[model samples]
Target: MNKHLIVVTAALLMAALAACPACLAQTAPKRSAPEERQEQKDARAARITERIELVIARFDNNKERHVAAYNAAKARLKEAITELAEKGYDVTRLTADLQAWDGMFVKFAQDYATLINLLRTAEQYAPYESQGQFAAAIQQARAQLVTVRQDALDIRHYYQTVIRPDLQALKDQNPSSSPASSGT
Candidate 1:
């Protein structure tokens, strides 16, 4: 009888422990639908904030590379133009086109810098409470990026349409030795 009573007590204790979680769940305050929605919204905003920060970091890193590439290309073109001029080829049009391209490059760099600044501003306002400001900054940055894209395209178009053709014409005009070499 003693053994049976001990076994029954242990079983009752185990059952009570198993049911306590359900009892506590019923007593706990339930999250309303609105609260759940707000939580989801906050989680989404946090994810967007993280993405914006990542984009800003990447843009910052790419800025230096863009500047380096532009300088290298500009220098190469200038050197080529000087060499051609020394070889008695007329590079007047090439020189003008180069100047125009340089102006476009300057605008591109400026616009890119503006976009970076806007991105930084957006990062500053990425909190859910300041979503409106963050969105505005993102829009401004997007517009600036469009301007930068157009500037880059204009540079490429000018180089391909005007500069390259002029360069090819100069090469064709002086297929033989340089004037000095020809005189030798």
Candidate 2:
């Protein structure tokens, strides 16, 4: 009977020990100090660099698209002018349309440069984690860069959906559905 009781107690103790880790695991997780090391920061930066490169490549790939859109807009503008001339609409009225997006193309180009510079800066600063303040700054800049890129996409979408249709409408129902006017 004594041996049986001892065996039962040992079994129960072994089960309890096995269950303790599961119970503890239900709470906060343990993180080793290495997770907070410079290597981790560098790895994160590398991943961000890869993402940035892919995004840049995609953006470049869309260059033809962007130029095509611009060309279409210009062609429509010319058509609108020709229609107005035929209809005897004053030439100066077209100035409103021309000035609508004035300076925006240059601004957009500058914005791309700014984003590229910001990404390069982040890549450079990413591994320099010795200074906590600098590391925090790098993180903040990266976050802001994400916002900037998102804002750029939003602007592009707005142009495609809202502005392009309006320009096409100004062409007096002349649909912009051909790649013949692609090169700008």
How high is each candidate's TM-score?
0.70, 0.48
lDDT of 1 by residue, 48-123 (tens): 8788779878876776777787789888888877877667766677777778878888888888888888877887
Residue range with the least summed lDDT across 10 consecutive positions in model 1: 175-184
Model 2 CA deviation exceeding 4 Å by range: 1-41, 62-64, 127-184
Query: At residue 41, what lDDT does model 2 achieve?
Result: 76
TM-score between model 1 and native: 0.70
Per-residue lDDT over 1-184 for candidate 2, one digit per residue giving the tens place of the 0 to 100 score: 9999999999999999999989989886767788667568778778867876786677666644765675677567667666555554444435444454434544555665665665556555544554664455456656755665665565566567755665455456433333222111
Q: lDDT of all the models against the reference?
A: 0.78, 0.60
TM-score of 2: 0.48
Clashes of 1: 0
Error in Å for residue 74 of model 2: 2.4
Which residue pairs in candidate 2 collide?
Answer: none
